[model samples]
Target: MASEVVALVNPNTEAALPFATTLQLVVGQATEKGRKSQNEDAIGIRIPSGLALITKGVVSVISDGVSTAEGGAHASAISVSNFLADYYSTPESWGVQTSSSKVLTALNRWLYGLGQDYRDARRGFVCTFSALVFKSCSVHMLHVGDSRIYRFRHGELLQLTHDHSTNINSSNQYLTRALGMDVNLDVDYKTLSVEVDDVYLMTTDGVHDVLTEFEIHQKLTVLCQQHSTLSDDLCEQFCLMLNKKAFDLGSKDNLSSQLLSVSQLPKQAIDDVYQSLSSQPFPPPLSVGMKLDGYQVTHTLHQSQRSQVYRVVNDQGEAFCMKTPSVNYIDDAAYIERFMLESWIGQRINSTHVVKVVELQKIKSALYYVTEFLSGISLGEWLTQHKKAPVEEVLLLLKQIELGIRAFHRRETLHQDLKPDNIFITREGVVKIIDFGSCYIKGVAEISSPLTRDRILGTADYTAPEVILGYQADGRADLFSLAVIAFEMLAGQLPFKGKLEKCRTRQDYQRLDYISVHQLNPMVPEWMDNALKKALNIDPNLRQADTCELIHQLTTAKANQTVKDFVPLIARNPVRFWQVISIALFLCLVASLLNN
Candidate 1:
């Protein structure tokens, strides 16, 4: 495999102000090459305001150096990265038109001059360059040499830059264009409209020479499924995987890849465009005389930040919850998609333990989702009113919750956020797990934003250890959360408590301790104690692998009683205790008299 590096830039250009653009670069060499032969360098700059001559948006640049029979490649690459970083850091004197292009040309000349001054320069410490500049609705890319730039849209691949290499026969090659090759350079530049879900990739020959474009595309698709946030760690992993793939194919040269993804359309411009498109008159609310599809919105049930839930009645007078995006989010395409996804996933998962979605509806100016209305109190209210249920009852309720979660896990889904409020219990003792809003289908993880990692999605107290550590959460994380809820149910208090209002940070959760629950509830059985301990283990690997095993142990242990349950006969009744003592004293007196 060949080593690859990937990154994602925020689509909200306004919000991405400080950095304006993001950059990532990685370099890899075969094990046979003992020392670092080449270096990867990256630079990012925010184009100053009023610089219309230059691009007004962000400019990101990356370079990968490759040298044969010389050690200057590493130094040359680092020098260029540092120089560009400094040049872009200050206010630019040149405007957007040619300011950026001019700056790059100057850098190119500097590299050429440096190479001419050194003896090893004759061999040429050449480097491939790729840069992305965002202005208004478009992105411009400049490229040279074997360093490549690729664009992906809707699962299709487009190679944006062609390699500049002269083939002598089959294997021997000479560079046609590169920075530091001569006193002058011929750079390839292209401009195109930037759209949401578009991804750009740039890499050194190390990546392209080893892994085919198809192979690189496949790995990117896989990585997108597991991660929504892009980081240095993820980039490193991508690079390592590529290098591994390249080595397997017998590549002996250095390798590197840089990937940048555009997750969302420019939010402001896109929102404005969507609003303009949806400028039609709103139809009057459905009246008693008119029908919408087949059901009537009998009344509006509730309204929240993102959407509204309505109480609807079918022609037969059956009730259902019809949810529609709030007017504010009506033009918000991303929110609409998320709402639809939640409804879709909820409908796919049909279980008594989960809330059910009946159907999805799209009307003028709005999208609606119909679901079954749950008639019960939320677990949060139940906990507050009941304080704590009997230990046995708590155990039974926990078993029910665990079984419900197991059902989801079996379907290869993980409820990313599970908490008391999202769970409900009817008066008839039926448990319904509600809120698939934060639920994620297993094996599909990538989303639009890399900043998603910074946003904590679930309730603080219930998040798992792995989640806190910024790892991809699975069914085991859910089990850890369920264990916390179990502990709270038995102890009448959370396992972790502090002055903080919520356990949002890992530090807030350090207060959790197993002994605390045991101290509060002495009636807790030894078997139950051990089960909770194992379930709440900080290390996910040490925790119970399956929730089914936990349920079985708790049920079986409840059935069996051991010596630990025994109490002295005298302790059961004080009067019986006195009589037994008196009889013992009389027997002792009789023995003494007989002996005399």
Candidate 2:
């Protein structure tokens, strides 16, 4: 049996968030062989020190090897090692759920494959797994098999995970769901808000099955009271004592336990974030054939006041597009912050519909990032090529864009800037959404930024009215932008002719009339126009809730169009019907005048 303790402190004196920096934790772990010939249980904790601790947070994993399986100890060790390793390497833009789940899924598949190669179904690489991740102010948990995670706070004990075991008989139980047992693995994930003084525990089945929740709580309470004040030594001793007690209770399997106490929570400080954002200076502008780091500039792909994109080739003859901050706003801290965030967001969002940001092999010169060169035409150009596209074709493209937007939404990010130019269609008919410079992340928004942006970040024609009205936009705003794009694709024009930027008030927006798509393109059905109207509603509350709803309305709109068949003639053909009525009235007046 052995016990270890690790402690951390707030390293950065300069902070970026508005709140004071206070996130701290104390951790302790212990493992015991018990009566087993060898200990097959593995436990590990990674409490990153600086920015990593703030961005990625802390990770702790505990895995229990199947006693009857061969190489179970090795399997448990690998599961913990691979999970912590891959999780940090994942893009920081990804939420904790995404990063943790992806790493676990890949780890599960590897273990299952190894088990299949062993050719022994029962004695294969199998184990139960559970993990706890403390990031920012939230604790995210991922679980599989029978390992348990528990929270003990203020005399109350809460079990955070469910066991995946089935009782086969009174004396024997089997894991219903575990890594290496199936080709496909399902992981349970959840998140909880963290507060100071909270205590969390992770235990392998060997320890948890023997020790009741009340017993564990009592042990934790005693240790906390003895310390009077929290310390790493106290936590370490408590973990060892808890594991030893479990073994004393006649636990025959390898035992492992981990304890974590929240000492502080992270807060965004304006200066700290500014310093991190402005750590690197902007690179100078480059000309064709100019060499930067190892990249040779081949062409100028794009140029804007905010950024410059260049097609570059590396020493290995691989092509990439390097985007650098525009020198025009080099001194603008807020602009630089958003520019850096654009790179981070690009790296985080993984979708074929979105552009891929490549990781450079070596540190590059200045502050810039590279991306895979996409050989495709912008949606704007595609629109010019295929004006008045069929509804089906437009729907297909819109669906792809929606998928990309949903990916952003999953990460709690909103792509505030969505327009025809931001979308691309590859030669193979693959549609992608690009340009995340104007994205808004919930986490980032919570931080106190150095600059306050009063201006809208979206294009005038495609921007939702709510944004123009100085309100915070959400996923529905992105849906509105997509709706406008869809309307342009089908009708070859915007739903409203006036500029949104010019509408400073609600009444100004209300005065702008929505033009029927059917009037622009007679091929457009009334039902389709109705769908667009709902999506393009000046009031965001009236717009479709999400892209999926909009898609459903657009696809099933034909049924609604059928209802238009029964409309009164005056309603359907008001122009022709009113013209006949006017002529008849004129003849009657003429006859009356003649008789008089």
Candidate 3:
């Protein structure tokens, strides 16, 4: 019998960050010219509501103008204002770090270009910037100057940003790093957990450098109290007093201060929903003429021992694929949770190359979910027709696959089950990755669960050796699988002559040798074959670090390429290999002496 299909929606709408979601924030900021003619410092705070609040979160930034620069004020203002605009403008699918980094990189370049007309670039646009992104219950911090970010929590105040200036004879210091100082911007970045009632303080050097850390703590202690409510009046008063206090403490430079206090955070309920829905009983099987909920089944696409997929249409005549879990494992809680997460993960990943989970407007009465129906052929089926596709064609398709995989990676997800069957080429020639039953979400992994989540996912033929041996899976695992697919496309057969699937142990995998693509297809170039071989290495550490590197190797060959027939024992680490050999020999000698 087919299980009723109902796509589970994550409460946050977007997948939650590593922890927490839907943060409510109260913010305030104050700035002063201090004895300067113009306030060369800038500050801003943005709190988005609704789904964006969960995905993009709140952003706060402060930038300090270089004291010696001619356009410090303009530079500071542009950095903070443009960052606020560009950050949220970036694809919502991007992680906080990625979005900020890209914006900063582009912002720096634009600022640097503005100063190119002036002699002695230091006399032009330049500033130090510090930013804090509060998303979910996590804080992503990015800094490039002496501007400061601090957190007041549990009755204690902690500084979160490092001062980038180096001391000159302990008496004086000039800025060593600042935005627009060079063509490349190197910012310090990190992610940390944020708790309810957590208070964040941002400041320019005019405030932080003059006022002692103790003084800042005193202000935060009075401004932030234990509660789910935020005090705008008190928070604003704190910022004004902070900037004024710095000026009163013999400060001569422009000053700015910003405060943000978390009022409430969404509770961790991702796994709870899974556990609750998992208790729902499996529905009886349905045929082509039968209807489950509003979806009317038109054809049974595929059926397996674990699940069944069918083409169905809604009352509006919109086509969709309804996937139902099999009744065989109705009592298996872990399996059911994983099955539910499949749709949840798909909803978070927004990419043209990925099949999206469609949310039916009607209420579901059963346990099945639906996805977009595509009139296309699976990569497995396409491969059967074109045994030897052109090199350019394979590279183009592989890049698209990599692009799709990145959409999941951005959400801290891993498509652990990646094979030709899980990939589809739509009628318009778009490559779409489908099926997330074996996917891993880093945030979900952090949640403590009694049930074992790891048990070797994906087909053994393409699974990384580390994954098979119970090691934590990462991007390298996906890269290995991608390489296997690449080899299959070029050679029309699996590498290692299909012996990889039989590997049940480390020794078994060690015994298997990789079959060169060149041996199977002479049309393949030596450099391209070498690149594939490296990606297909049994030892994942020996493979390309990422898909980008693999793609580069495939598209651009080395000046003097050398083909390696196999990955040597020393490929992973020669020093470690010799150290193990030395240890083994010494142990053998000790055994011989004991026996004698």
RMSD of each: 21.8, 12.0, 6.4
* Per-residue lDDT of candidate 1, residues 205-257 (tens digit): 65577788888889878877777655546665675667667767876566555
Residue-level lDDT tens digits of model 3 in 1-596: 11111222544232222223346788889998999988899988888765566567789999998978888889999999999999988754466777888899998998898888798877889999999987766788999989899988888999988888998876578887889888998999998887888888898888888899888787666655433366777677788988888888888888899888888765534455445555456667778978887789999999999999999998899899999889997866567777767777777789999998986566556667789999989999989999989878888899889889878887777788889999999989999998888887764553334455545379988787878888777788898898899999999999999988888887877777767797898888888888888887777777888877887888886641664546566765566899999999999999999999
Which sections of candidate 2 miss by over 4 Å? 1-22, 118-120, 168-170, 268-340, 343-414, 421-437, 441-480, 495-596
Error of model 2, residue 577, in angstroms = 33
Poorest lDDT segment (10 consecutive residues) of candidate 1: 10-19
Every candidate's lDDT: 0.60, 0.79, 0.80
Quote model 2's TM-score. 0.63
What lDDT does candidate 2 reach at residue 506? 78
Which digits, one per residue and each the tens of the lDDT, describe model 2 over residues 447-471? Answer: 3334664343688788888887878
Clashing pairs in 3: 1-285, 2-285, 4-367, 4-368, 5-368, 5-369, 6-368, 6-369
Top of the candidates by lDDT? 3
